[model samples]
Target: MSLTSVEALTQVRARTLALVAHLDDADLERQVDPLMSPLVWDLAHIAAYEDLWLVHRYAGEALLHPDLAARYDAFETPRSVRGEIELLDAPGAREYLRDVRDRTLQAINGRGPDGVLHEMVARHELQHTETMRQAMRLGGLLAPGEPHLDPLTGPDGWLDVPAGAFAMGAPDGAFSYDNERPRHDVEVGAFRIARRPVTNGTWLSFTEGGGYQRREWWSDEGWAWKEDYDITHCPDAEAGHPDAPVCHVSWFEADAFARWSGGRLPTEAEWERAATWSQGTDPLQAVGQVWEWTSSWFGGYPGFVAHPYREYSEVFFGRSYRVLRGGSWATDSRLATTTFRNWDLPQRRQIFAGVRLAADPEVN
Candidate 1:
């Protein structure tokens, strides 16, 4: 017999709950500034979101609490402050989560599988998993306790990609955000991108050699961000190490570094082309090492049509955010698809972000 939605939900819930096992209340409550949420709030929000989107919205179930709808329906009103999640207090939180999961599964079992709903919930849950890891990192917890490759593995030993143009975005019926919509053709010229992301060792060279201090290395905006933040290299910056992937730098920062090194950041088209270079036959996804910052701004294509997930992308267009290709170690494998794109403001840095180098074919 096939596993029921309830059973799957149980499994997902178990995994989410397990993430908190190693975390104390302090860790759970800790906030990584304004960009991220407290783990306590994050966990509760995930449960509430599953209930709201899958169970109630798609499955046609009643809300557990009528008044709770507004709080849970945060796609319209994205939370800025990590509100106190009194509803998620220890025993009550677990019980509430179980209730939501069980009820949602029961509905799913009777209604059967809804492909769109399933995909959305799956993606949403995957996002939460990444948020959990970001929270862990913010809480100073990143030891895997087992084997996992470092973030900055360059594409040095990997297969070389031939020059070609490939279909970049989602086709029909794919659960893609609006930013990836109106699936368009992008011509990718021959180029060479590092197989893996840039290592901390490489990034440090630029920084230590006056990378941030030099005006020539920075763009107008990049220079402002540096000067405004009074940016200075930490002699003990963790990202300054050789093996670590360069983290904590903005897209502009990475771009400046790339510019300083006589290269340029990859465009969205180029990044996608490099990522899906071997799309049909390749088994290994090029994501999950780190969140690769692309030089592309988050914007709609020529004939873009907004979908239900429009807010996920279009709302932030022409704003401070930029396009980031590839998921990170903190990202869920489901969300780690080659086509998946993550975005944040240029100045914001909290997650496991790292830079990768791409060069023009002629330059290489």
Candidate 2:
């Protein structure tokens, strides 16, 4: 059954609230990392976005609180400086969110479905839910009750993705970010990819074998990043247990580890092919264990066009960022689809990032 716009919005809003229910006032206000917004900021931002898009843009209503436009404008204030901004306290933030949601829901009910804006807000909130979860995990304040990925129970081996042309991006008919557009065909040569993400135990071996100390396994840029950051091992290796996928790894680190294992990070095309393969029995597991790094740079697809949320994809189409596929444990399952494209700077390590090995068919 298709979900009515109101139902979808309510479901996603409930999930957003549930993710923050366990946090205390202090937890809500704390900025866990330089890269992530504080929980309170995120809370207000969700409401702010809903009001901005749904209430103001879709329903033709005036802004509930005009003062909030600049306060919660993410594009204006960088994450590093959010804590210093005069954000609402926990109670105030909740009150503001309640107000915005109340007004937005009233408009939705009165006006009926407002086309794709409802779904757009729902997806936006869901993405922030994952961001908040990552902040909680990084802060060591994550509630134990949150959902987790299942253990690596799938068959242990590499899956051979045959050499051929395959449909590469999200086709028309679904709501996908602009970067996943045009549904073009991509020619990928036969390659083998592990069924699961690289685990902490595997990464530990790399560290013990001097993976970080040796420059041969790393690209010149990667080696510089490693040295500049003084990264000797996975940032959270001591915290994450051995069997878990390593988290807080940069693309450079992921690249070095793949090379050290006599493999390489899969290109975006190979990763997507393995993920979307339908020819044989499905052979992937623990896809949401972590955001697996890919060799591809973040760029516009052929004939790419900006969607309604222009900055969502257009702002990052360059060599400055590398692509990541799949999703992390913090990701909402709805946003963790095969066609979703996530990218970050190669030097960023705070997010729930990890690696999956891929190799040429002959090498395997």
Cα lDDT computed for each candidate against the true fold: 0.68, 0.85
How do the residues 1-364 of candidate 1 rate in per-residue lDDT, one tens digit apiece? 1344455556666777777777666666666555666666666677777787777888888877666555555563355745443435545456667787777778777887676566666667667867767656665664455114364433353334566767878777656666666777777677667666666677777877988888998889878987998876633244345675666667777888888877777787887776666555342234576788888878878887766666666777786778887877666665676677788777766656767777766543
- Candidate 1, run of 10 with poorest lDDT: 146-155
lDDT of 2 by residue, 80-131 (tens): 8998878899998889888998998888787876656788788888988878
Deviation from native of the Cα of residue 171 in model 1, angstroms: 3.8
Please identify model 1 stretches exceeding 4 Å from their true place: 1-8, 30-32, 75-79, 83-87, 141-164, 173-175, 234-241, 279-286
The global Cα lDDT (0 to 1) of model 1 is 0.68
Clashes of each: 4, 0
Would you estimate the TM-scores of all the predictions? Answer: 0.86, 0.95
How does model 1 score by TM-score? 0.86
Q: List residue ranges in candidate 2 displaced over 4 A.
A: 145-150
How many clashing residue pairs, candidate 1?
4
User: Cα RMSD (Å) between model 1 and the true structure?
Assistant: 3.5
lDDT of 2 at 167: 94
